[model samples]
Target: MTRPVRRTRRALQVAGAVGAALLALSACSSSSGSSGSGSSATSDSSKSSSPKVSGTVTVFAAASLKESFTSLGKEFEKQHPGTKATFNFGGSDTLAASITGGAPADVFAAASPKTMAIVTDKKDAATTPITFVRNQLEIATLPGNPDKVSSLKDLTKSGLKVVLCDKTVPCGAAAQKALDASHLRLTPVSYEQDVKSALTKVELKEADAAVVYRTDVKAAGDKVEGVEFPESAKAINDYPIALLKNAPNAAAAKAFIELVTSAEGQKVLSRAGFLKP
Candidate 1:
C-alpha cells in the first residue's frame, strides 16, 4: 500500500510540471500577438498629455509695464514648458506704430485705450481689445523731495526744470490733460519720448521733476520719489491688450493674454501700482 501511494504522488508532481510549462507557452504566444501595441499606446498617451510647442512669441508692450511684463513673460514661459516670450517694451504709441508698420508681434499691450484704438481702428488687431489695467500720472522727483514739487501748481514755478512725455505717448497725454484741467502750464526742459525716459530724466537728476505714470514711479522704487497730485485723478489712463492680426503664433498669443489677465498676473501688476480694469 505504501509503494502504491508513492507512485501516485510522483504522477501528481509530473502532471503539475507539465501544466506549468503549458501556461508559460500560452503567455509567450499572447505577448507576441500584442508585440508593439502596448508600447504604441504608451507613446500615444505621452504625445497627447504634453504636446510640444516651440517658437518665439514677440510681445510689444508699453514702457510703464516693463518690470511687471518682464516678470510675467518669464512666468508664462515656465507654465508653457517649451514656449519662449520675447518682449519689446517702449511707448504705447511707438509700439502701435511698429505693429501697424509690419513688425512681427504676437501681442500688443498699450498703456492707454487711445493707443489701442489706433490699432483697432486700422484693423491691425486680431481680436477686440481688452482693458486690463488703469494707471494715473504722478510727479517723479529727486529722492527726498528735493524739488518741493508737492502739487501740479509747483510744476509751473520759474526755474524748475521739468520733464514731460511727448503728447504722442499716453503718459504725456495724461499729463497734458491734467495740466489743462488744473489751468496750469508747465514748460519742461525736455519732452521725453516715453514715460520711462521721463522718469529716467528725474532719476538721473537731469530734470527737477517729471510727469510720468504712478506705476513707473513705483517701479523705480527709491530711485525717484513719487509726488501724488490731485490733478492726476482727472487723467486716469486705461491699458488695453490684444493679439496682432497677423500673429505668428496665435494660440500661444491667446494663452499669454489669458495668463496676463489671470489673478496671478493681476497681482504682479498691482504690486507695480497698476489698478485692475
Candidate 2:
C-alpha cells in the first residue's frame, strides 16, 4: 500500500511538471509572434510617414530669373524636407552650354526657347520642355533719363553711348531681332556678357541706355528707369524649363519642376514681372 501511494505521488508530480513546461512553451510562442507583428507595424508606419526623397538638385537658370527662382527655391525647401537647391544663374546660352557639357545639373531654365532648343537638339534634355514664362525687352536708362533715350531708334543717335548684351546671350539675340524688325541699326559702345552687366552699365551711368528684359528693370528698382519700347512686343522671349537626361537626382529634379509649375511658384514669378506662359 505504501509503494502504490509513492507511485501515485510521483505520477502527479510528473504530470504537473509536464503541464508547466507546455504552458511556458505556449507563452514564449505568443510573445515571439506579438514581437514580430509589432516590428512589422513599426516598419510600415515609418514607410508611410513620408516619401523618402533626398539629395541636392542643381539648377541652371537664366539671369533674368535670379530673384524669383531664388525665392522659389527657398519655398521648395520648406515643402520638401531634406532637399536643397543649388542654382547657377547666368545667360541662358551659357547655362545651356554648361548643361550639354555634363555640368551635372538636374534642371535647366532658359530665358528663350532658342537657348533651350540647343539642349533639346543635342538630346541632353530628359523630357519635352515646357514654356514657363515670357519676358519682353525694355530700354533701361539712367534714373533721370539724361540721354533721353525714347525708343529703339533713339539708341542710334550719335553720342548716345548705348550698351547691348553680347549676341551669345538670349537678351542680346532678342534685341537684335527687334532691331531687325524695326529696320534700325545702332552701334553700342560695349557688348556686355549678360543682361545684368548691361543694366549695371546703365545703372552706373556708364552707358546712356541698355536694352534689357522688363523683369530686369523691375528688379533693378530705384537703380534705373525702364522705358517701354513698342518693338518689344515683336521680340518677346519665352522661357522654357526641362530636366537634364543625365541628372544625378532624377526624383528631386522632377519634384523641383512640379514646384515651379505650381500656383505658388507662378505667383513668385509674376511678382518678378514674368508673364505666365
- Poorly placed runs, candidate 2 (over 4 Å): 1-50
Which lDDT values do the candidates have, in the order given? 0.91, 0.91
Please give each candidate's TM-score: 0.82, 0.82
Q: Candidate 1's residue-wise lDDT over 1-277, tens digit each?
A: 9999999999999999999999999999999878778889889999899645567778999999899999998999998888899999998988898888889999999988899988998899999999999998999999998767889999888999999999999999999999899988888899988898999898888988998988888989999998999989999999999999999988889888999999999999999999879
Evaluate model 2: give its lDDT: 0.91
Predicted candidate 2 versus true structure: per-residue lDDT over 4-68, tens digit per residue:
99999999999999999999999999999999999999999998996666888899999888999
What are the per-model C-alpha RMSD values against the true structure? Answer: 4.6, 6.9
The stretch of ten residues in a row with the least summed lDDT in candidate 2 is 50-59
Deviation (Å) of 277 in candidate 2: 0.8
Per-residue error (Å), model 2, residue 133: 0.4
